[model samples]
Target: MVSSSLFNRASKVFPGGVNSPVRYYTPEPIYFARAKGTKLLDEEGKEYLDFSMGFGAVFTGYANSDILDTQMEIFANPVPEGVVNEKEIILGEMINEAVPSMEMMRFTNSGTEATMHAIRLARAFTGRDIIVKMNGGFHGAHDYVLIGAGSGAATFGTPTSPGIPEEIGKTVLVGEFNHRESLEQIFEKHGNNIAAVIVEPIMGNMGVILPEPCFLEFLRDITEAHGALLIFDEVITGFRFRYGAYQDMIGIRPDLTTMGKIIGGGLPVGVFGGREEIMKNISPQGKVYQSGTFSANPYTMATGIATLEYLKKIDYQSTIRLACWIEDKLKPYEDMGLKVNRAYNMFTPFFNQQRVWDYPSAVASDSLKFMTFFRGLLKHGIYLSPGQFETSFVGPAHSPESVEMAAFKMVYTLENEMNESGNA
Candidate 1:
């Protein structure tokens, strides 16, 4: 049995015994001593091939030497007085160059702050009151973005949290993912009132549901027609799916885009940016205001610069190829009654009879079976995201050999689950 001493101590001081609700598991989270590359070594010295990948932030890998060196360099020579750090300047320039839609970018400490500021900018620019978000999509923990939050929110069975005032929740309209009709319904009713429509082009929070054909185009069309800004919350899909934003992959240009995870290079960072016209609405340029003391802290900028520079040199196609291989390897499991699926490097093996397209379907999956399979995989030295709604990430750290090992463990875990249930 794992020790509850750490968790027990944590519960006394921290809510739910974890700093982040998503990190909390049924029994308790495993305390890790350290992580290197694709592997995590727990406090008890148990090793597991980690697929969680810091919630898809550590795209380059854990403890990357290049990033560490850059971080050290930043530490050695603090920010020069009256001189902006070259790393932040370079990162901003690189992002603007790579994603043409983002003419000006402002860094934040996390995705929540990015979305919060983006929404504020949209409202200020458009002079509108309402914000539309997908029913199961998660933007971040802020009251405005947390409407119909997924992951821990779904697990708790409260689509919208209780602490938020009724006035705040009323402004957040929820639409269904992949269903343009639902969006149209919401838009037709309150199109003029909406300041912005924020969406995850590839729905990562709700189990990797890809947008239906022309769904993104419909969003662009409707939002444009209604004079509402379309904000693509690419916190998960920004750099992971492709070199630029996933919006580029789908051939749609969002008025504003919020990015986190990989952009931070495993450090705490978030960014929101878009056309110069809308961006000017923020801070010194316009009436709308947003700021953070640690927004562009030199350490995070250094790590982000190193990570993006390294990413520019990587063969993204090769990483996608490895993901495709893992997908192919798991295809057989679907025939065995497991609902295995993949979208980019995010993959899931759902123990359900039907496909999961939205929050309802996603929650209908067999959580108990997933829990069993999760324990089985853990026993076999493979780590997976603890919840059914969360996606299992594959990163640059996971090589073909490491993926093959994980595949074997997954198959064995499924087989064991089937056996115990007398379905094998």
Candidate 2:
């Protein structure tokens, strides 16, 4: 039997016995002892291929040799007090150089911090009160952005968390993901009072929902016409989909952008950047204030610099080709009455027959069927995210061999699930 002792001890200390609610499982959670490359070993020593990738943070993969070496080098020499370290400077310069819109960048501890600061900056810059967000998009656990979380939040069917005050929640306005008309209506009514419109650009949190054609351009046009700032929450899509920002691929630029995941090279890091005139509104330049003691620590900076250096030399088209291969293998599952959707290296296999477009469609996926598929994949030594609403990630470590293995496991799991459901 799996151990419940760690969870039992943890429950009394941490709320839900996990640092984040998404990590919690229904029957029991497996405790991982160690992880390397694309695999993780549980406490009981069972090995499974890991597609979670620390919730899409480990783009280069776990325990990368170059990142490890950089970490060691930073630890060997402590930086002098009151002096800015070279690693931090280099990482900042790399971001600004690669992403054209980022004239100035500020680091934060997590994506939540980056987004929270971005919203504040928008409010400060535009002098407006209301903020707009996509219906199923998740920015972070912060009150403003938590208006509509996708998986665990959607599983419970309460998109809005309980602790967030209704008064504070009222400041947030929700719009459909790809529906331009819904956003237009919201802007038509509250356009004058709106300060910023924050979006995922590619909605990874809601199971890799790609924005409708010209959807991002529409946001840019609307926000600019209304004198509000557009903020692309590229925490997941930043470095993974492309070299800099996914916006570059979309061919539209937001006034401000928030980034996370691959930026830290697996360490905890977040950053928000945009034009210099708008960025200068932040503290030390203007009144809007944000600060963190360990925002640009040497350890994370070293790892980030090393990761970017390696990423700069690699070919993105080759990585995208691998993603297409995985998607092609799973495409036949539609014949089994399952709806499989994918974008770049992120993909999802929904149990329902209908195409998932918005929050309602995403939640309409059969939960029981998904649970069985998830458990079967786990038994077959392939690890998927515990919740169906979460996207399964592929990275540099996931070779074509591993993708084939995962495809076989998925096919077997789907067949078994269909047989059990009397639909085979």
Candidate 3:
């Protein structure tokens, strides 16, 4: 009742009663009272085993003691935004050291800013206008990224959102996730006009899709051949699988890399960096302009440092173990005509029978039935990502017991309660 009432009040001010489109649902989104690790307690005092994990931002888990300690230190010191701080320098060094391709980098307020600036930097450095993005790949909410986004934007019923000038869309080219010929055709035609090919090496916003073998290497080679920069958008995938960027694991160094989410330690942050010759193009060195009052704020930098420090010592295999346990339990989902796609610890149960490898396949999932299962799980004290297009993450925060309980409830719901009629 309190959550319902809060939603009613919020509706009067915020559009759709939510700041983010993915946060809204039919009955009304539940307001969280508090969160710790993989648990979220609602205003109604209902506890949920959280599989969303701050939409893949809370890598080390929510309300972590180390992050809390950093908060306390910031409070005692009263570090304000819009100042150069030693903490920022330390965080920059940590990221550059982890992802060697990022010889130099710049921090921003959000992933959108990072990608927007990266696109501009690429254009300025190359003196070309076109940016090619994968069909389902989501860089951020900026205009160029939103043009050809997949399921994430599809939640709002449009892959190419309105209000963007027609000319802006012309600057971006769309390519298939795993298919190589799509890129071949695009570059063959517009290679000279292309400033960069911005892509998500491992797609996350369109659910967890891994790259095909040699696909990334091909991207590296083709971009170099055409004189275009290769940019890896690691907003969600940066540290999701390992301590470093995904490009490093694949042995391909992108000309630029954009990162956020986990690197921020549950705080708002974004970073874009690459080879020294290219990064120097950003303002204070070259002409491309990018600045924010919150950029390199002390709080986020200190919190990130604490998170990386904690991350260095923990065993990431724990997350994989949890995923494997749920995968075994959810084998019944396949029997129910659903497919679960996983990349390391992040996974999604698509309402499609075939394996999902790209944007087209991801879009084919039965979203209506997914909402039915989603509602059923919610009633059973589980909080998954609200859309079929979104991903469910397991981190150090999730325990085996919580995952087991969630799996059992999910199975029970699919077996006895599901209608496939969109009726919860």
Worst 10 residues of 1 by lDDT: 149-158
Candidate 1 regions exceeding 4 Å error are 80-84, 149-159, 418-424
Q: Whole-model Cα lDDT per candidate?
A: 0.82, 0.82, 0.86
If ranked by TM-score, best first, what sequence of candidates would result? 3, 1, 2
lDDT of 3 by residue, 36-66 (tens): 8888999989998899988999988888886
Which pairs, if any, clash in model 3? Answer: none
Candidate 3: lDDT over CA atoms?
A: 0.86
Best by lDDT: 3
lDDT of 3 at 393: 92
Candidate 2, lDDT over the whole model: 0.82
- Model 3 Cα displacement at 327 (Å)? 1.7
Every model's TM-score: 0.94, 0.94, 0.96
Q: Which ten residues in a row have the lowest lDDT in candidate 3?
A: 149-158
RMSD, one per candidate, in order: 3.6, 3.6, 3.1
Instruction: Write candidate 2's Cα lDDT for 1-424 as tens digits.
Output: 5548878877899998888889987666778889999999988899999888888898888888867887787778766533477777899999998888888989887999999999999998988878888887889888888775224211111238788776665667787778888788888888998899999988877676777788889999999999989999999999887789898987888899999889999999999999899999999898999998888877788889999988887677666676677677777877665776777888777877888777778888876677678877888888887777888888877887887888887887776655564221
**How well does candidate 1 match the true structure, expressed as C-alpha RMSD?**
3.6
